[model samples]
Target: MAEVAILGGGCFWCTEAVYLEVKGVTKVESGYTGGAQPNPTYEQVCTGETGHAEVVRLEFDPAQISYRDLLVIFFTIHDPTTLNRQGNDVGTQYRSVIFYETPEQEATARQVIAEMAHVWDAPIVTELAPAAPFYKAEDYHQNYFAQHPLQGYCAFVVAPKVAKFRKTYADKLKT
Candidate 1:
């Protein structure tokens, strides 16, 4: 069975783009979670009033890629030290967070964050919370980087993250 990981490390587009290249990730969907709203639209989430963070729902084969490895990749691809922001994208919706579905997931997330803390110069501000309702983003938000690779945001913001992942984790990339 495929295990799921919900992560919000700034824009979902950046996270989705990098994970899509991982060897065991079967699917990546951009969404909103960790919020009060039941089904927030992208615009609503973008407003930062929804209390939701833009997150990516990833389905991965654990036999091929451990959840720990996925978390490692996630931490590396984004700046978790910056609270409520990633690069120029700033807002509560862009905050770094991990919505774990189980006790085991929560423990793993904690361990990863602790381990990652030493790597960063500043404290790891990534939030660790229990899984909540995940509202799928609009149709246009899905596979955004792939569909609009040449778009300004994708070309500039998301592309570098994908490139860094490919370079840093070449063995984890799909053949």
Candidate 2:
């Protein structure tokens, strides 16, 4: 009934767009975390100096979608096996990570990763870390994909990820 899930899976734009469509997600904030810098900017994160991964802070109603369901959708939308990269975007900031809010969430993330890893050929490299401070991204970056779907990056990269998420989590969508 109550929980928070923070995840970093590739570009925050792609992850934000996908989670926005999930029914239980009451709020989705694109941000930076697991880094050293306080209030790191998108540019700073892009530079990878903050030691923080670009992340999304999700506020969801667990009654509608369990944290476990969020983990499944996250795994589906991003390539968790790759290290510090998702497709063409490469950097430490782009690393796949899950910031668990509790011991239960941590366990669930690990269990899901283990199960899904067996289902896929590649080893899962998604890092499971304790939740840390999350600095919200720039205003324009908040909803990048939906705001700029025609943008080259969005058209070629984010759209496909969103479409895949929609198909995969069809039952869990917000409608």
Candidate 3:
């Protein structure tokens, strides 16, 4: 047992898929957070006005995987340099964010962002916010890619993201 972390890189489905493959990750729940509304539906969230970014909350063992490692995979899998967008998905709801579960997590997130700034040319726009009420997304959103890899969005978007994660973070993955 360790700590929990919440991150939004774009679609929760994609983030959930990648984290689930990590060895220390005990659970990954697709959910909504950083929003004005409470328990917003998926339809409401996609509108980009819910104030909530689609996020995946992960419960993991720190002894096996560090939050720092998770951030590395996160930055690699998606464009944190981009503001309010991941490829075609555009909106504040798609912005890169890390909702920290503790003070230590918050501090670590800030430190990682600073280090990444030198690693990448563009500035990282990832927000380090305190963890809020996490509203679990509909059941249909869970394990989306694993269950529906043949779906168009899963093929075009999630497949590449997962492959990139597997390729770039091979040593960190759960084999």
TM-score of each: 0.98, 0.97, 0.97
Range of the 10 consecutive residues with the lowest summed lDDT in candidate 2: 166-175
Model 3: ten consecutive residues of lowest lDDT: 69-78
Clashing pairs in 1: none
**Candidate 3 wrongly placed segments (more than 4 Å):** none
Candidate 3 whole-model C-alpha lDDT, 0 to 1: 0.91
Stretches of candidate 2 above 4 Å error?
none
Give the per-residue lDDT of model 2 (tens digit) for 8-53.
9989999999999999899999999998888888888899777999
lDDT of 1 by residue, 34-58 (tens): 8898889988998999999999999
Error of 2 at 87 (Å): 0.7
Ranking by lDDT: 1, 2, 3
User: Model 2: which residue pairs collide?
Assistant: 35-51, 35-52
